[model samples]
Target: MDESGSAASVDVVLPCLNERGALPWVLSRLPQGYRAIVADNGSTDGSAELAAELGAMVVREGTRGFGSAAHAGLRAATADYVAFCDCDGSMDPAQLPTLLAPILSGTADLVLGSRQPRRGSWPVHARIANVWLAWRLRRLTGGKITDLGPMRAARREGLVSLRLQDRRSGYPLEMFLAAHRHGWRIAELPITYFPRTGKSKITGTIRGTITALRDMSAQLRSARHLCRGGAAPSVRDTEEEA
Candidate 1:
């Protein structure tokens, strides 16, 4: 794995809230040698215990937001490279190595997995919302990336240095925007997206998708406003609810 030798040195952070039903398959499919750190965000469904029993290192994050759980795992990671994957069955951990290829080969500073959703994977409303967000991103940064996805990989130190601030649904988009603002080389690769196990919250539900769209739209507006004013907004410049 890019001179890092064994893949054991890579840590995969799986942020979870209530993914107890999907824990088994998600943890089981992690590629050999990659460590799984499940950051549990108040899962009353026993998700944290289930992940621990499955041999994943579990960290309890009290804050109830995707970014909080994600950031906590990043701090807990002791690996050369880190990957963020959904604990739900939608994303396959096996595809993480593909996302990390650019980082490992020094071809990119940040690599995001552009999901090629199979049937029944992504809902129409969610997909349309993502299209709008991606279009806004292109207008702001003129970058080639078309999808802002959750499955992503990057060197631990460089990602931490981005100082990403959003703790809610906007977290992933904030990471993308920050990388562009800092002139980090960003790349995207296609990954298969499947229907999630159990009840889907953010992407599957209309209310959840609207919540995420509002958060992301705010981030985009702030970025555009700042960029037009001749100043790239710092990570903290956009104040958002975690």
Candidate 2:
């Protein structure tokens, strides 16, 4: 619902740290007719202020993980469709149109931008990790989610119904698994995966990579429990039944 008395079209929520340098380029490239929300994770580098200056809704969610900040941004989204992408300029905002089209057309409840490996772009370890995690997700949730982290779009109601609870690095996997369990239609669209310009606080650091792997393993376990316990329907099960 919006002030115009019509359903909001789409809202893009980007979780940002101290990415002021990259924010402008990303913001400038966003498609028309979509509002941007920048969830600041306790950044003191004027990121929030800069987002406000750029006319994006700046929300401060302190002491939160990337997932927590993303959840906050989703909660603040007021559109019929909600999309999220990183602020590191690695993912091009122009790719959003194809990802969002399926949701807008009533074909998919959740849409994930599959991070197609670019030539000489991503590091070798990241590619290996992504493949391993995607396989794990398929084994645990029967969802066949190809990309754990990418620019994603989904219906607001479907996303809200998932009640995504992971507040740490595991959020993206949790979201895909939840959607699977709820019988929500999910689809993947190929997108360019570029190496980010700024420092990657998550992947570039040793500690962060270890934490991410742990969180990913935890998500697989959680997904198994949820699907087997009749608490939710795995995406594959739902699709097959339909």
Candidate 3:
């Protein structure tokens, strides 16, 4: 049992790039009884070493994509439930229980931590983009999803069955769409969002936003095609799962 007097049953996966400055803060705030997995995407700032020193299992992935790193972390997770949180300091690791509660109570399969942005936490342009994308998602899936924030949790088996294929920014969208298609129960809870410690790789610049938009647009199109009775692509487990 941990400080909370509960046995650890969740693996919290942090898909990190060069988040050395933010990782320590995030790790320190994590609630008790949760295993931390730092999925390092070629961070040159010794992020992996820091995570290991902090007692997190560090898994290094050479592929430089958010989805790739996230998937790798999920594959390495051994818990019955897995949670994803950004290591960029914007998300609070202490609030993880909010995402995990619904899943553990059999009320939801996936629980997203919707950003209740603190003052100055979000840029105007990014907030507008997120609102539009979330609107599109609600329309496409007929679900009450509000934000596609990075902080989320789901059952390990249910997530794996989605066979998510996006290796870029579209990964989160693909997960939602595929989960909806597969009849997985999804929910969201509001969480505090703070300013990040360093520059964001995505949503920090016009070019990054455009690239992310392109990738997610393609994913939305593919989801539409699949919904229209198109053949499903072959699903394969990651090497870790194999």
Candidate 4:
């Protein structure tokens, strides 16, 4: 373990929706000393209760979108840094230190976990979408990001300073784009991706993919406009049902 891991405080945010079956496993694997916060998006499966029982701080977001829940968790974070990962059993919390190391060492402001997918971990359609999206992001931001995988970490204040406003799947991409525009140093580290326990809310169906693409397209356009000297778009709470 790095010495910084012991000194730097971090809060891991798990944005979940009806992930009761996987929450126990995910929470159990979290490293000692890191606060875990579960952002529940109105789950009927008692996920919030279970997470709270497992010693995680549970924040309930009334809205129903990935970005809505994620943003709630980020706001609830009270540590020097915040780390986010899916609570669907696909990402191992034990590997969180890998994402935190660079940020703790002052080498990077943002650390993205590049997924090394296990067999059957990533569907073909999802893989294609991720590849294309990553390529487009690299082009737009002139950054070397390869994967927009969910597992990531960054300084809490820096992330909040970006003033991200997307309330859908576009949230992650918007963060990267804004970080790039602000000249924040970003780095990617490979992490294992396991098969999830439940059906995916996004990337599992064609409709989900299309909806995510639409949201991302809008964010990309805003990014381009900002890069061309246009003023940053006003932040608003817009909900998209996905």
Candidate 5:
């Protein structure tokens, strides 16, 4: 922690979308010692106003994609490290230290928060979709990306290098592929996951499912082309294959 009460000199970015129902609880749970910024994706629920009231610098993302909102938040960050997460309370903010551990210790440039073993939490369709997407991403990137969980930490420079391309559903997988292609050291830490409050914006809908599948497939195809040039071993690859 620093004198300014942050775990590291990094900034935390949360992307919100009418998260007013649960955003405050998430904010309150953030490790007291950290500085945070909230990027509201044109929420009419006063999410931006509420976040401002809670002392988080709020940036507006008129575009309505998870990646777009996060990118907007990342731009607002001015720190050596930038961590991005959803404003939903499913992820534990207290475990931020564990997620940032690899980066802080110089072992990794990107830190992903993997969900611990769980079942019967979310709808069966969501679970299945998550598993399928993760499997495809791992196969495409040759990295054992266990979960597409949104809680992630990364060094600012490497993160910027990723140049996250997807403005929608494929963002996490796209970021991982970009990092892998650029030889950024990536690591993951197990974190708890729970069903979030409020209706999910991405599940149990045909459009959502199609969008996720299309985006993942397109990104994976592009990643294959990128990997045909060369391959960098992933931390998971070394651990498992060795």
Candidate 6:
């Protein structure tokens, strides 16, 4: 139901890259009434085909990046609300309705699923980095947002209104900070987390973790400066200038 108290369509965007191993379960687990859009980012394992065969609308993103695929899916969505979830099976799509409740009720502009990590589901070092980033966000927003999780739901138009610029690991951060700057009411809901079915291409290895930290930290720094100056700056824009 949307804020108008009527039924609303939802589009769930699953960013894919050889996630064929997990697609079946992930797609199957999506809450009823939610349409799946698998944004395949150059997957070589026939992930796109499998997703299409599984009845999901598959959109190919040649520009390979989490943000590239996610943004593409967002653009393709015609639903009243849009959600993003990892195709690696780390998150359960059944909980999406809970996350989206706030928005549909007009209580929040954006809602993020805070991961309640199960043992071995999250690496200690990566947890530390995530903690630091969350702390930075709290300091910037003065709100209690604990996790920068992949599972989130928001209005499709509000997201498009942000004109989010990042097409990499920084995309999530960029979107969060931009929403804050635009005075969006952001909220978080806790969800159970599990180990990914396949090896994570990002944030599962040292190199990928480092790259994420680099991008996220840059976004944090830019947001900090924005806080001081009341200017909404973006990480990718700052990097492009350099």
Could you give candidate 6's per-residue lDDT for residues 1-242 as a string of tens digits? 66666666899999998999999999999877899999987889999999999999999977877788888999999998999998988899988999999988889999999999988889888889889889988988988999988899999999999998778788889899999999999999999899989888878877778677777878888788887896655466323311
Q: Write the per-residue lDDT of candidate 2 for residues 131-226, one digit (tens) a residue.
A: 888887777756767777658998877788788766667778878877877788888888888767677767677866876776767777667777
Model 3 bad stretches (over 4 Å)? 1-8, 232-242
The 0-to-1 C-alpha lDDT of every candidate, in the order given, reads 0.85, 0.78, 0.85, 0.87, 0.74, 0.87
Better of 3 and 5 by TM-score: 3
Q: Estimate, for each residue in 1-242, the C-alpha lDDT of model 5 and write its tens digit.
A: 53354557768888887788878788887775567789877788888999999888889977777677878888888888788777877776778877877887788888888877355346777678778877877777677787777789988877876766677767777787788778888788898876676756655467766666666666777677666764522222111110
Lowest-scoring 10 consecutive residues by lDDT in candidate 4?
A: 233-242
Candidate 2 has its poorest 10 consecutive residues by lDDT at: 233-242
* 233 Cα displacement, candidate 5 (Å): 24
Model 3 per-residue lDDT tens digits across residues 94-187: 9998788888878888899999998988989989989998998888888898899889999898888887887778788888888888898989
Global Cα RMSD, each model: 2.2, 6.6, 4.0, 1.9, 7.0, 2.4
Q: Could you tell me which 10 consecutive residues in candidate 6 have the lowest summed lDDT? A: 233-242
Instruction: Kindly report which residue stretches of model 5 are placed more than 4 angstroms away from their true locations once superposed.
Output: 1-7, 117-120, 229-242
Model 1 C-alpha lDDT versus the unseen true structure: 0.85
TM-score of 3: 0.91
Judge candidate 6 at residue 113 and give its lDDT.
95
Q: What is candidate 1's lDDT per residue for 1-242, written digit by digit as tens? A: 67556554689999998999899999988887689999988888999999999999999977777787898999899898999999999999988888888888899989999989999988888888778878878888999888899999988998899887777788898889889988999998999999999898677777667667767876787688778875644444223444
Candidate 6 achieves a global lDDT of 0.87
Q: TM-score per candidate, in order?
A: 0.92, 0.88, 0.91, 0.94, 0.86, 0.94
**Which residue pairs of candidate 1 clash?**
none
Query: Which of candidates 2 and 5 is the stronger one according to TM-score?
Result: 2
Model 4, 21-105: lDDT tens digits are: 9999999999877888999988989999999999999999888888999999999998988999999999998999889988888
